[model samples]
Target chain A: MADSPIVGYADALFSVAEAEGNLSAVEDELFGFAQTFQANEELRSTLADASVPVARRLQLIEDLLDGKASATTASLISMVVSAGRANDLPAIVDAFVDRSAGSRNKAVATVRSAIDLTGEQRQRLTEAIKTSTGKEVEVKVVIDPSVLGGAITEIGDDIIDGSVRRRLNQLRESFR
Target chain B: MVASLVSLMSIVAFAGPASASGESVGSCVAEKFEESLHHHGESDHVTSDDIHHVAHDEAVQDELEACLEAPSPILPELTEIIWGGAAFLILLVIMVKKGFPAVKGAMDARSEKIRADLDAAEQAKTDAQTVQSDYEAQLADAKTESARIIEEARVTADQLRTDLSAQAEASIAEMREKAAADVEAQKAQAIADLRAEVSGIALGAAERVVQSSLDADAQARLIDAYIDEVTGSNG
Candidate 1:
């Protein structure tokens, strides 16, 4: 059967990394790169500016992800920047992550927190969500200070919100 | 010379003969000579002689000197005074008769003309003043008419505005009343529909209870009792 376009890209990248024997490392690095690109507006605008030379934009991607990502992941990001598809980078990465999760028969669980969780806290929260949902979940944690405190988790259409901002909004609504 | 010759001939004849015809001729010649001498002499000399001849010729010459020594009226001098006085009186009469009347007539005519002109000017001025007053009155009337029209228009506009506003308010009130009536009717209809549904459910429940509890004969008896009770009440 023919795979989806996003699945094809993810399979190609995964096969290449597996051939190099660095699939897990490349996947982790690409996940962080996708989150960074999603969070930074200025970086996104610079990469998406049509007027900026493609070569210069590639260089910026290299400078941002060179040391922090696997060589294969860095090269893949540069390739995407050079192709003038920087705006689609986050979508492509998200699709790739989803494809990778589907291959393992796990649901992609996106978790946003106001601060970084400790290793023990992350493992406990992941296990608790897996137990509650009765499914294996690939937890993708995004540290977002705008959440104020606590965490908000989304597994498909199910949202488990435990943030201070959400509590305050509910309190304000009850008064109104 | 003729008169002296006549006189000398008469004197010689009288002295020489006394004949009847000679004496008569001599007297006649003497009378003719005296008449001629009277004609020849000047009047002044004759007057002196008349005075002096009664006395003597030498005495008349003395009287003539005395008369010259005294003041006498000369003819030329008297004639000049008389003519000058007559000419002055004539000139005075001519001025009164002709020149004075002509001057008076001209003055009267000029004064009459001036009076007529002044009368005409006064009449023209009065006419002009009347025209000006008429124009002013017309202007005032026009202004008053405009003011009255403007006031009437303003009153009409205000009345129209008031009528429109009243109509709008009444229409809005009517709309509100219609909406309230419609809402009340809908509520009543909903209540009626709910009551009909509840009545259906109640009837179904009552039928189930009766069918489960009663047999066929007991149902027929209950129906007959219900009919008899209704008929007895009607009777």
Candidate 2:
């Protein structure tokens, strides 16, 4: 967790979703929404611009995800955005996923790529993360185009960087 | 002179007959003889005796006339003139004895008093000259002292003004520098604040773009590729 308050918010949202019997859908929706917010610059700008009041930001979230997500999931995100935590949404969601995985003695495998992963690939990647780290893992995929191409993975303290963006940055630094 | 001629005329007019003393005696004697003749007539009535008596009287009168007619027989008196001359000589001797010495002594005292007065006037003139000279010396010194004081005051005033001007210029320069520095500091601070605000906006916008690209479908695809790579590597 990045901060205690952020962790506290994550725990609180997790308990609410669990109690509603919609924990799986809530977590999945929240994780996917957080990734979308992190990836789209214009969308993030609209959501986080102080000129757009918090009320407006909340309304925007409702218009997009009101019926698409569970009431608890939508409400939790609306609460976070309305309470002025749009900038911290990705951190809060990541913390929640980590907490969820930790409940089952599993590590979180955060993956970034330009395209969505298939179910077989997710299964294989999870087993591979378990085999490499010698621990059980729950894979969470985040789509990012700034990855440009290829993929980057974060498992606990380890980072596997295979993204085209990293290669380009290395090339730039070398020229300098 | 006329009073003396009148007295001479009056003396000639009142003078007696030249045979007055004898005539007067002879007359008285004839008067006595006549008385006797009258007594004799009464006794004898005698006429020839009376005629003889008258003849004798005429002879005695002629003798008396001869004596009175002499002019050089009498002289004037001299005893009263001698007594007046002796009284005038005694008065002249009293004047010479006392009056001359007293007049001479008075003239000498008056001359000595005039000489002392002239000497006192000369001493007074000298004292006046010395007092005038001392006053002139003091007045000259005062004039010189006043001139020196005025000169010194003028110099001091000029220097004071010069020093004051320099101090004012220095103070003005210092204040100007301080004001310029303050303006520069304020300008730098405003730029720093704008930079921070701009950087925040840029970072937020970048984050939003990255998030927008990482949709669920894209995230799933990236997960699939990462899984293939990881498993393939292990295999």
Candidate 3:
């Protein structure tokens, strides 16, 4: 998660976001974009394909995040893509988010859900995780249909798998 | 006259003093009587007185005695000896001319026959020895050939046994490997079947529960319940 090149890129992105005075917004948007990049096989492959030409890859990044992300977030992703680091987009973004959370003395928890969490549900879930893990927590939600229902949360190496998918898998394993 | 002559000879023979030795006197008188008989035929018969006068002649009696007293000659007569020698020479000439060649010819033929028989016997002995040599050589060759055949048979039997043993071992190994493969395949198929059944049953039941019970209100309640459970466990 914290290889040297990935940390260096993350530190540079964090410094840029902080200098722009929109660290929180850029970090959140970048985290969500990274999740999208990881989820979409075509987007991940195209962005990482060195044969696609840097100009074309940059244009594809701009088109994908046009109005969906802040200008600062789009520019930072384009910078990473143009620099041929698009293949490490998820890792760099994760490192940046972790660094950002650490500055505020909190841990980052990536949560996968079948449905989008309400604002109240997010606050409650965050509070519950902070209590359970004994750390100030920042929750990042990834809408994943494969979760089936409920949620699966990953905080560092620990995973809290509460999804119906996990329950069904356990039932399958019992027969063996 | 002949009867008177014979009577007168008888009386004169008895009256002679020399007539006491009858063998000599009788032989002389018989000779004279045969002469007188031959000289005087039956036509000239003489009386008994005339026969007595002739018989009393002393000169005739002396002459007969003198003839009987003379010694005989030792040699045969020349004419008889000459004839006997001539006959013997002729017989010897015939034996030399005819008998000797025939005897020699017969003896030569007998000797030739005996020599021929000995040669034949010798030739037969040599032929018998040659036949014996050939038979011995053939017997030796037959023994060598039989020994060679037996060796070949032994080698062939060993090779056949080795080949059969190897084939049997290979067959056993192949069977064992095939059996193991079959067991493994069955185990894998059974596991897959069990997994599919469990997945169908568990997923079907879960899907039904989620679809029927997971309304907006129920979803909210479940989320709230999970939050409460986490906080309570940690606190």
Candidate 4:
């Protein structure tokens, strides 16, 4: 993972977010934007398309992250997009989150839910993950409606799934 | 009998006077008899009875002498007998010289002809018998050939029947195997299709149920429940 070009981009984004003195907020905003970019095929295609003008792609990134992300997060995403690395945006953001979590001496955990979790729930989930892993963990929650209900937490290679969608899939497999 | 003798004697007396120039023996004998009878009549001057008896005796003696001098009535002339014997001998010699040989030659030729005809007929019979024997042998050979051909045909027919039976059996076996495999395949495919359809229906119904009951409170409850479950399990 560290040998990938995504690591270099993540490092560049990490350096810029750390220098801006808001690494955690930029990392969280970038992670949310990366999820949106992963889910939106049109946005990813537009950003990665070579025939599109670089200025236009940068403008589109600016427009999507306008008021929602900090200037450092927007600028880092715009730099990656302008560099024709939009298709690798999710990987770059994930690497950036991993680096940020590593600096705090914590493992990164990606959590998926059908609905937005309350602050208390996120805190409880982070503590639950840290207890389950026996290590400090930074939890990143992605609102994925396909989760249907409950949540699925991915910590390193481990997955703790408590999803209605997973239950339905298991039921479908049993029928076969 | 006496009249025929006298007619025969008269015929002889007339034939003798015709042949010699002299008086016939029968007339001479009658003159003598008459002379004697006149003498006797003369001598008998004593009685008439004695003279008649003497005349009859003299007449019988003169007739007897005349018969003695006549030729024998049953005997042929010597020259006629000799000539008849000569003629018979000549005819017998001619028959022996020419007719016997001719008759014998004709009989011998007829016998030879008969014998030659018999030989030709015997040869013809032998040839006919030989031809019949050859025909019988040929017929026997033909029968054997016919039997051999019939046997060969029977064997060929048997082999062909056996081969056809085997082929038919093989074909039937292959068809049966293929049919069994097809049935198994169809059965398996049907089972798979049923499983897929039932799974799809059950899954669709479960999704609907889950979607219907999932309100905001339920979602929060599920999240809290997941955190509690994970923390409890880990703890």
Best by TM-score: 4
Q: Model 1, B145-177: lDDT tens per residue?
A: 999999999999999999999999999999999
Residues A1-176, model 3: lDDT tens digits = 47999999999999999999999999989998998899899999999999998999889988988898889999999999989998898999999999999999999988887777899988998999888988788989899877667778889998887776787678767756
Which candidate do you rate higher for DockQ, 3 or 4? 4
Ranking by DockQ: 4, 3, 2, 1
The clash tally of candidate 3 reads: 0
DockQ-based class of model 1? incorrect
Residue B17 CA error for candidate 4 (Å)? 70
Model 1 ranges with Cα > 4 A deviation: A1-8, B1-169, B172-235
Tens-place lDDT per residue, model 3, B1-235, is: 3334544564554444333333455576677654554444443677675466545656655655654663336755454455446545655565566666666788888888888888888888889888988898899989899999999999999999999999999999999998998899999898888788877886788777875667767656755766677678668
Off by over 4 Å in 3: B1-188, B191-195, B201-205, B208-213
Give DockQ for candidates 1 onward, in order. Answer: 0.00, 0.15, 0.29, 0.58
Error in Å for residue B193 of model 1: 41
After superposition, the stretches of candidate 2 with alpha carbons farther than 4 Å from their true spots are A45-55, A169-176, B1-229, B232-235
lDDT of 2 by residue, A26-117 (tens): 88999989988887888788887888887878788888886788778889998887777878889899888888878778878888876666
Q: What interface root-mean-square deviation (Å) does model 4 yield?
A: 1.0
